[model samples]
Target: MTAPLWGAVPLQADEWRFGLWAPSAADVALRLDGTLHPMTRGPDGAWQVSCPARANLPYMFRVDGTDYPDPASRLQVDGPEGPSLTVDPSQFDWGSHWQGRPFEEAVIFELHIGTFTTEGTFEAATHRLADLAAMGVTVIELMPVSQFSGARGWGYDGVLIRAPQPDYGSPDAMRTFVRTAQELGMAVLLDLVMNHFGPFGNLLPAYVPEMFSDRATPWGAAIDFARPQVQAFFHEAAMGWLHDYRLDGFRFDAVHQIRDGRDQKVMRDLARDLRASAPDRPLHLICEDERNLPSLRENGYDAEWNDDWHNALHVALTGEHQGYYSRFANAPFDHLARAMARGQVDEGQPSPEEPRGAPSAHLPWTAFINSNLTHDQVGNRAHGERLISLVGETPARVIHAALLLMPFVPMLFMGEEEGSTAPFHFFCDPPDDDSCEAVRKGRRAELAGIGYEVDGMLDPCGEAAFDVSRPYPAEDADRAAAWRDLTRRLIDLRMAHIVPLLRSGKIGDGTVSRPTARSFDAAWRFEGGTLRVCLALGTPLGAVEGTPIFTMGDLARDAFALHVEITS
Candidate 1:
């Protein structure tokens, strides 16, 4: 037993120092290399021990005679229930001369790395970085990569916070990924889940009760961010990703679930601490807050996932209102206008999901990331339907144009730009047979009452679910090409005409009245310029006088959209 700080600390090629936060334990021991080494306790109730770290070495902390994986494990072998391994962070050489892209000039592409490429590895996904960069994507927001239990799962169930999923290769794989992405002029932001750990192999409760709180989130447990040591654990997680991984940003998952019963808000404190971690390099701290509050930006988030905007636009375009989609059921177009005019809608209004949400007053459009489709909006549905599938192709394109034309920053879910036929279903690999059965039941029950999809229709734990979730090459060549062409033109139009005016705060108050039953003539004041956006719902729009800056399809057709920079 010896004195050392928390986490796996490498001393030499073979020797390593290990520590664990086990305040509630009466005794602690390091179980590794087929031997039990007694650990010494620190003043702050941490247990420390030193041991050998080899490629074959598997280790665990035995506190009060119960063995558990290290809470702050940097790398894990086998899985979360498996042993923690020592990782050497000094070997990798990160790229140089790159700061993160600001939200003001960002076009985010959110992807599930496991399903982004055929091989589903970080190394394999690196092959497509150039393709994305060429498509005008500025930031690549990766779905979580933490070590969840089993052969395959979406990373939200991860138990090991610092370690990359073994299924996706090692830590160096991620290091190489970040370095290569930075070199390719694309910034990578990792999605991290701190609200709760997965159902299986989560060891914090055994080590100490203070690690978690009595409060619970929709997933399961809520972490005790109010506690000093617990807060430090998460703070280190943020610092490790920025300073160690050399990543551009962190997309904190479901921040609305984090409960801190204290004056020093955990999120603000964590953000300030993260900002201080790497002063030389720029880093963004984004949040996924369902509450749609503007104050979160003040708390340190660069931007938030604007579900309200999506909900409003989705109901308006598709007219399929069910489950969480019902919030915008009453007057969808009005909500859409509110979202465009103020960057948010239904502020302080009571709804099914939340009791009351804070008004998003004076929030810059850039502060809200607008998109027609997101992981939750598409994947969390009962059947995991894509936006294009939910609505007709023409309506989807019109909505896409409307989404990109908004003053807010734009994002695309994986395969959305290419219009791939594959669906991103809510799929996960459960650890055991009973657990798998439980998962299927839970998933069915969740959607059953909502009337999105009836029970026993889709199984989240099935391999078929993952099979359908994988992104493939775009379906039909000519249709794919047309969609691709439309995407390029819309992005070009946005970057050239709309984005500049938006950043300058010239794109002001906008309105959308039902011009016809199947058409909308929407226009936003561009200060000194006039920009008219017509989403005809495949309904014919009349010819414009000046050369229209951008048109998705023939101006005579109503389904396609037409965007004209009114110069008169």
Candidate 2:
């Protein structure tokens, strides 16, 4: 096994130079545009070839006299098994934009294009760009648009890495989606899964068996990043998205499952290469890892979705301690208090479940608090209970306000802003029985630990899950207005004061004090020169108590202490 070529520049541009370590193959040829370009075998057991004028040419690879698709093709027109297309990055007309927002300042909005709107297409989703921009969202993080087996999917099961899903419209539609978002001053973040491919319609194995490693993940053995050829495959895949699609950043899904026993981490190598390749462009790497934060920081990721904050906040607000929320039931307010101020909750203590030493001491984490309406939380549940259903509207609104006010980068799932009454059920459209069975078994096994029955959850093969997850349009004008007002005010507060104070590290000790009788209700108060207080009244009460009186006694003589409720 050869060591990874860290930050190695490609041989040349336009002329595609390809290399793969395949000692087992007797012969190798680079197939492009119905032509075979014979690859020369190097002394290191690595096959190399450079095809002249290969830009914008459709191509594939043949190993040991048998044809196979390029595992790391830049443009896959059909499925992963289909012929590869060499797309010229310069062909697209980027209208008057060359820069993206810094990772720290970005307010990311994660959305599934198929479910975000009534029309499940990129062009239709583009129409909502103004709404996202109006909500102060700086980045629209799309859950993988890559072509899968069928019409509808969550995108994690995508087999075609390069091609945009045809159901979500064509390649032009995706380009328009990005262009529209860019025109609206919002950078586009694409979610990429380098860890593993779905079972359905994947043709990668037909070409290179080494693509799937001997190592195992929860899903299955993923692409072998430690292997020399596998490393090259993934590196090129990462660069391809940046160069071909012009994606601003990538949200690596389930990166913890990317098994590599090599000395150099594949993620670190990818990050290093991406930075070296496009030093000017903003390339944010966000991971969804349940492990300690040190791995993410040391591996050079911009941010990791801080689920610890979410878990703690969920338990605090709803008192639902099932599944993984069990570990955070007795967690002190100081955990959340510190996270609000410092961006991490498990900074010091060892996780109750994981045997890891302890989480990273301090790291900036995107805080997702008190919002249980996310796909993972809702769909994974037995009954698919929405947040409003589990916790009443009053408590839900209070929790939502607290989440927005929290110091870390806040993200709202689709329909979450308006108190979306609709449930986000787990959905997929697998083409075959084998793929469908794999999905059903996988989801069932994952939920079994939480005491949820497989039969209870929506089947990935069924059309019910896909249909149930769709958003319900706002019927009541009052509810719609309330949601709009709440979001606008929260966003304004974040921009005006909370973010600045958090950045400066000036916001000191704060507490969400709640009346003993009404524990679900709470008030957040910041202690400083100018006292800022935000109260959430969950229940209708004649009188509410608790006020912090300073020694200065700045209150006016005639001014009596009164509860102030700001409702639109």
Candidate 3:
């Protein structure tokens, strides 16, 4: 493993070096396994102490009398408030071989580790990977596993950016999870948060306050990425995760909030460095940037979460236009058509909600990862209602089939394919401080502002929120099996038809035409042939001319059909 700028690094069998960066502190000391040792301070406020390599030894840095956990900690044996533990990442055996699959062939399944299984540990989650693989999920995107305060969280509010949450088992267990997925011919993509650190257990502001700019994000203070130290800090974390655990890639959370003023942006640097780190392996870098900047794809991003597609589809299917969904409320079908053909709905279009995005028609369809539902769409709601609850089973099933056959890459939230109706509430367990109350009030206000009735909303900080949010596959075993069967068949069809067209990576900008008010025909030309999809909601679809791949509902009723026409 490459030695990180900070954290516990093992050099030799008998030598373990611990380092901390605290330029603001007058003095810094390393307390290793209950033993206090004075560290040597260098010219750059970098303090280092070389001790005997002791794995699992509890350690913390005492900066000017107060003890603080390592910001780059790999494992917090007793949560974020406690001392960090020393770990040798090379200790885990990866077993045989796994090189990972290409991003084009990806069928992403986004799962939150804490709620994905009853055990909520990496070990437990690893056991269920084969099930997902069998369902034709090629990529498993784990929501952030970074250690936060307390136990339960969406992982966006992670404090220790490098450490794996103690609730999710050891660092080696996470490694084993990745290896297990790879063995099943599946890649693991971690949702990484580098925009801002969580409110609790963060020691950066306590010591190095200059790391943050005066500007603040909705979550917290904006990280000052212009500073060389800050850039290197995030870089080390990204590279460390890539090398230490052999993770295939990362889906950077809310990169639109990553305000980097410098030409050498930290996000771009992260992608470049990670790509260079693993030239042989297909390392996918996806981002959730609301800006819809085409430059992200031009730079190094494999794909951007197509919120336009989801928003338009949601507004059409459910007719709930609150907050961001309001942007697509007017002419929802038109927005859906644009998203289906051009990859983005608000492509340089006038919108009062947000600034217009660049034209994305030139982008390959695979560059847009489209999904009907995601964690944000479900969890951000006051009650966290799944699509099935909002729009009924038939409409949801029709849309789900269309999502799989679309030219864009497809993603499924956990239990989405299984048609699980369990709500994915925005859950977190922070300290019982002002932050807890702030979270409660903030959520209430946000939901109220979005036109949701917030009085009966579930308390995000309560244990009940997390408990009821878990997807229960056993609750309706037969129905879930049917949903799984349908999903597997759709995925199997996608693999045999759509994936082959996408593999060439040479696809033309698609065309869209409204056959009826609620029905639209969209098609994209690839090297092999043209992939066509006609989705009709409460309207009859016109006769389609091609080899039928999949069809749902009757032609004279609400329906969705996908076809492939080979060019002579």
Candidate 4:
């Protein structure tokens, strides 16, 4: 609304000017600490007031007669329903030694702060970055930490796009968490939901009615990215994470819902602007859209999580065909091969359920995040089952071998490396009302879409569901140790040989051949040598007779190729 003075800005040592866009509000007042000062609105419908910027000063916006929280607030100390707090960005002390990490060899670990540790706090997660570094993780992808209504709900339902969730820790704790990760040579990527705001405690519409567009998403009203004001809001929010926290990158959740009905596409513009914001850093931008559109990378985004790979590979290994997986029934290995060699297997064909996607063979191998497990793949199901439980540990490890050794970038869900057996269920703690019922019914319909039943699904609002999802330290210490070692060895092999060969284009077109319906072999010939993997379904695979670089259990064979000089 106002020219370009976004949010609150410091004028002098203690003087700060509070600003907001509430074009629809006739009268506005700024409530700081306890006293309320009437704010003057300009002809353009922007409001402002300058006052003392005290540390941790609590404030709110009183529009007309209704009290509302600042939509641009950096820290929501209390819940989203409570007053906003002043977070002095200058006080956060990140050391001067952060030079940023390149994403060419990125290995991401997707973690939910609320369920990553026993404490579920940023400080608690900070203590574990060293261990992750030892595991050879290059980037730690944090689940959305943005402020949401209740304590937790996978953080996708965040209302405040900039503020960190108070339930996790202080605002400084978020900064410390990123600083610690960078100190360990691992970049921290924050997941953000820019499509729609959460249902409860949303105050933007209360002040500015045009903040939302006529277009609607399944979550709520679609943001009016067509408007210049709305575009500025998101642009500034992305800059906040880049400047305030020095976050290495960002992962946008379900970007398909961001409907920008205009001449200038919002996603492309936002990507261009974010890259301009940090010119010195190799800031990566990732998307989680079902449509593996190549234009997303052409625009400026770094990568996308290839769910096709997960679904195709999951059905192949577990032999479960339901929901979106029914299309991969013909030849599962072919589906896997297309994803490995080509970007996607569907090839612009009309999908079984939705009218989505096109051919992406033109896209490079670096355009997708190849992984066997992720939060959405596991949690969205009727029962939150990780790949390990569905296909058994040995088979899951065989799949993991292909995932980590492949040319594309790879990601791991939290606790997956150690085989913790924890269920990352879709749990929420919304209030008891019609909105809550809508969530239940919506989840039921969503699971039904995927060929799953909701008769025994865990109640999203129940505390027991949230409690059961936490990754307990170790009930089975020895098994955890074995999983950790196996994962470490596989990662070492990828970094030591596979990635180098792929970069130099020495790994030629890979071939996937099935010896029997029970097993398949994927081989790639390199100028130096060859890499072959034999995966047997439901049983231990036969020895390849080359060299065993890494082995899973009593299979007595590794996923690497034969007749090479490599040693493990």
RMSD in angstroms, all models? 3.2, 5.8, 1.9, 3.3
* Candidate 2 overall lDDT versus native: 0.64
lDDT of 2 by residue, 1-568 (tens): 3333211123455565665556667888877788888988877567777767445566766787776655545456565566766655556776776687765456667788888888888888998889878877777788887777777788887776656776788565687788888888788888887778876777666545667877777656667777766666667667767776677878888777776786347888888878778788777777777664566556667777777667766666677777887777765344455444445566545557654324443444332222334667776776566777766676666556656655456667777777877877777777678778987887788777676666767776788777777665656779967887777776766666555544443323333443322222222232322223333222222344345321111122111111322111
Q: What would the per-residue lDDT of candidate 4 be over residues 1-568, giving only the tens digit for each residue?
A: 3244346666778887887778888888988888898888877677888888776888888888887777878987588877888777887778776878767678899999998887889999999899988988889999998898888678988888888988899888888999889988999898988888888677677777878977778777788887777777787788787788988889988887766675338888878878887888788899988766777888889888888888888888878888667878767766776766675776677655555577676565667888888888888888787888876766676667667766678898888888877777898868667777878888888898877878888877777678778865555999888878877877888888766654554444556665545455666555545556555554444555556555444433433222222322
Give the TM-scores of the predictions, in the order they appear.
0.91, 0.82, 0.96, 0.91
lDDT of 2 at 517: 23
lDDT of each: 0.76, 0.64, 0.85, 0.77
Error of 3 at 94 (Å): 0.5
Best-fitting candidate, measured by lDDT? 3
Candidate 2 stretches greater than 4 Å from native: 1-21, 44-46, 52-57, 262-264, 331-342, 348-352, 355-361, 364-373, 441-449, 453-456, 472-474, 503-568
Give the RMSD in angstroms, all C-alphas superposed, for model 1. Answer: 3.2
**Candidate 4 deviant stretches above 4 angstroms:** 1-5, 40-44, 262-264, 350-355, 433-438, 445-450, 505-568
